[model samples]
Target: MTRAYLAFTETGLALAKRLAVALPGSVARCGRDGVSLAEWASAQFVHSDALIFVGAAGLAVRAIAPHCKSKTTDPAVVVVDECGRFAVPILSGHLGGANDLARAIAAVCGAVPVITTATDAHGIFAVDEWAKHQNCMVLEPERIKLVSGKLLAGQPVYYRADFPVMGTVPAGLFLADTPEKADFALTLCPTGQALHLVPRIGVLGIGCKRGTSAETLEAAFAAFCTRYGFAAQAVTAAASIDLKQNEPGLLAFCQAHGWPVRFYSAAQLRSVPGQFTPSPFVQSVTGVDNVCERAAVLDADGSLFYPKFACSGVTLALACRPFAPDWRWQNA
Candidate 1:
């Protein structure tokens, strides 16, 4: 689902087309009549996940300068030469993955990747990139530079994880016995003490009455999270039976929270293995004994963390994936 926009001049149009073939879901845009490069770049900046400009680095810099935002919000911006000799990531190198995209483009074009990031140059782990790979949200992203600076200075950066961590620990990052001793923490649970990386590992299964109000669903969701000690930000997706696919209340809640909804047919829900609360009324109406718990197990491909909880015609269940550290260090 990564949307990339390839903009190139006449001299680089051929390379752009080849690059488009390499990158799925990418559109190659040329400077056509009545469409200025600046306008095209601005539009892509707002709408796309990545913008690949196959021309001068200065041109790419100028085009994105006006639209430049913080590293967390801006899209990846990469510049390539006309002859496809070199690719350089000029903006949002780690969090937005511009550096990684530039390296991929370089590999495709048999060109060199001009990466200037200190951690990458030194073959050190980039915490933000590692967080993205693990589907975790970095709390206090503005402090990311401070963490990296300490690492580059050979300062200790201890980490404490509530979940089991696999693989060897990276340099400058040690396993802390307690959160108080750690410089950063990783957990699914919410904490206000230290900078934490929260994994989006929860799948929320919802079942609501046809006319359930958004306020009711929102309240139910909050109660579910609070009761289970789950952070709302850690829920990656929502699931339900196909009967609720068009339900306005459910759809609005998911849309507001930026969580994708997955719907399963009644038969599919019935096939999910679990000891769910069987309701004769629900089975008679929806052809399934349970929707919320079954849908959550199916979506997560894992066991449930919390069984069905119902309130005011809104039902919710949560499933979790196995906890494992997504190690990014090469040496590890």
Candidate 2:
């Protein structure tokens, strides 16, 4: 991950330099640079993956206070004293990986790592960390505490996965075959008030009529997800036939969702082996019997879970890549 080190003193700058060496792709900047701390931090907060402040924790906190946004999007913030005696992660500890970054920084400088997150402090299972490591996206981030709090309080946190998960289950977590008995659920179609997690394995394949408006495409896509009980966040990317590569509406819809679109040729779609819902009309125009389903399977390199559903001049399909959950935790 890209990181930047900010130092306010000679001692800190020296430590920053050493820390930067231990972590590659990191640059050390000292107060000698004409930029004010706030200005420098504002720019780096948006650009850097992690920000290491070689100064007091208070100074680091104050500097990053204004720029702090959602924990999901903010850069990991770590602080180390000029003496290099302690490394503290004061912000975005779990989802933003500040806790992990603090440990790394402390190890590099022989400093004590101060991690204060309740789950980490108690040595209990952290659902968010586990989901991140397993390449799963949390849908209701606000409800994360609902699950983690129960686990930390020695309460059971039940869960159920829509997909297959291998490996020994962690303590304090029970897998229920039913969603109603679970505190959290791993699924695209979530029920009840349980915290919902979607594995980042779905690929969406789309086909739209020529000159279809972006609004039309978006509404169709939303309806498709609602109809099939799939979370839009589960879809990591999109695919389509090459004939629609320049289709402005299709491209805009994917762009707005931050999903990159991969265009496959008609011949390529035909080569994808599957019993697709043949479409004579689609074949007449796009030279393929199916566009959405075939492209989805090809892009995912996995089985198509949802066949094509057509509506309002748009077609949508969903394919999912393989996923296997484990107990190990790492900042992904």
Each candidate structure's TM-score, on Cα atoms with residue i matched to residue i, is 0.88, 0.93
Put down candidate 2 lDDT per residue, 153-194, tens digits, no spaces.
888889988776777778899987677888888887777888
Please report how far candidate 2 places residue 96 from its true position, in Å. Answer: 0.7
**Candidate 2 ranges with C-alpha deviation above 4 Å:** 26-30, 330-332
State the lDDT of candidate 1 residue by residue for 287-311, as single tens digits: 9999999999999998898899998
Q: TM-score of the candidate numbered 1?
A: 0.88
Give the Å error, residue 12, model 1.
Answer: 1.8
Error of 2 at 56 (Å): 1.3
Strongest candidate by TM-score: 2
RMSD of each: 2.8, 1.9
Candidate 1 contains a number of clashing pairs equal to 0
Candidate 2 lands at a TM-score of 0.93
